[model samples]
Target chain A: SQQGEEDPQALSIQEGENATMNCSYKTSINNLQWYRQNSGRGLVHLILIRSNEREKHSGRLRVTLDTSKKSSSLLITASRAADTASYFCATPYVISYGKLTFGQGTILTVHP
Target chain B: EPEVTQTPSHQVTQMGQEVILRCVPISNHLYFYWYRQILGQKVEFLVSFYNNEISEKSEIFDDQFSVERPDGSNFTLKIRSTKLEDSAMYFCASRGRLRDSYEQYFGPGTRLTVT
Candidate 1:
């Protein structure tokens, strides 16, 4: 079964605006990571936030994890048309090593 | 920037026929994984391999599904008999040594169409 479930099935915003996507999971995790997919081709790794971490940033992408709530959120600042794609949050099953459960994902569209 | 790569960008096969999806991971990576995404669906994990053995797999990976690392860098997933429901985009991924990080590099998926 899918462990994580992303909110906002789809979102549209103008370039230069900020986009936020949230994900909720059901189990304990060593870490949570975010990925982006373009037209269902391949998933591009975005950022990872360990269980002990509350927030992390990479370039314009900011991610936050609230293990207590078993949720995470990804925020893209100053979005660009190129940022348009499906974003997913993934987590490793508590007991399974290397196996990741992916979320449904959120489709973000940035209009220039 | 080394990346994982899969061959036969797309494959069309008849139901009941066998199919093998091949992948070449980054030379220095050790962990290999197979995932699939059905049309308009989220990506699902199939299996993860390490040390020439299956480390983990999801319920979706049944007896009909098998994974192999034929050689050092080439990893393959084979389906004993294709089913119409098996049609999906298959992706191969790999990550470097454990000490590096948990980041995985995914290859361009191979679209499998079982008719």
Candidate 2:
């Protein structure tokens, strides 16, 4: 199974600033997903990019995947206080076949 | 919008006790899953169920854990004789059937505190 590891274990940025986090994984993957979890709560799926795709966008969020580096990056533009949450990158693998393996996560704190 | 719902948002039990976490996935979804997140750690997949059977499970899922679709809408995960290490938040998720594309919807987790 592929295990995604997010860089900058913790990040703090001012509201309206852009925040970027990187994730690297072990083994090959079918797709990579990004999710956000509020403190002590369930996770909300943000975006997903397949192995063949390079970049994807949803509103203010942009995700880029570099297969050769076996890594992916998530960039949140013009962040807000509501964006304060743990951002996790997950890679789907065949071991648990289609099950997602998540990263330790980047605890993002956006200050107003 | 449809959302997955879980029961008993929080549970407190003693070691060696039995616990059953219930989840009501989105009405039209076909795939269900269980995952756990220990404090200050990553989310871990426990099991995934489809067609009333476990399609896959993680090493963390041992004999003590079992899952069943007791009815059409409810999915349950039973942990027998829970250990202190069982303290974590358990999340239930569902996904519509898609061979090439899969987007899972997760329910608010149940925080289990094993005392």
TM-score of each: 0.97, 0.97
- Per residue, candidate 1 scores C-alpha lDDT tens digits across A20-104 of 9999999788899999999858999999899999999999999999989999999999999999999999987766657778989
Error of 1 at B51 (Å): 0.4
The lDDT per prediction is 0.91, 0.92
Count clashing residue pairs per candidate: 0, 0
Clashing pairs in 1: none
| Top DockQ model | 1
A1-112, model 2: which lDDT tens digit per residue? 4785798899999999999999999888778999999999999999999888999999999999999999999999999999999999988774454688899999999999
TM-score, candidate number 2: 0.97
Local accuracy of candidate 2 as per-residue lDDT tens digits, B19-110:
99999999988889999999988899999998889999989999999999998999999999999999999999998867665778899999
What fraction of native interface contacts does model 2 preserve?
A: 0.78
Interface RMSD of each: 0.9, 1.2
Model 2 bad stretches (over 4 Å): none
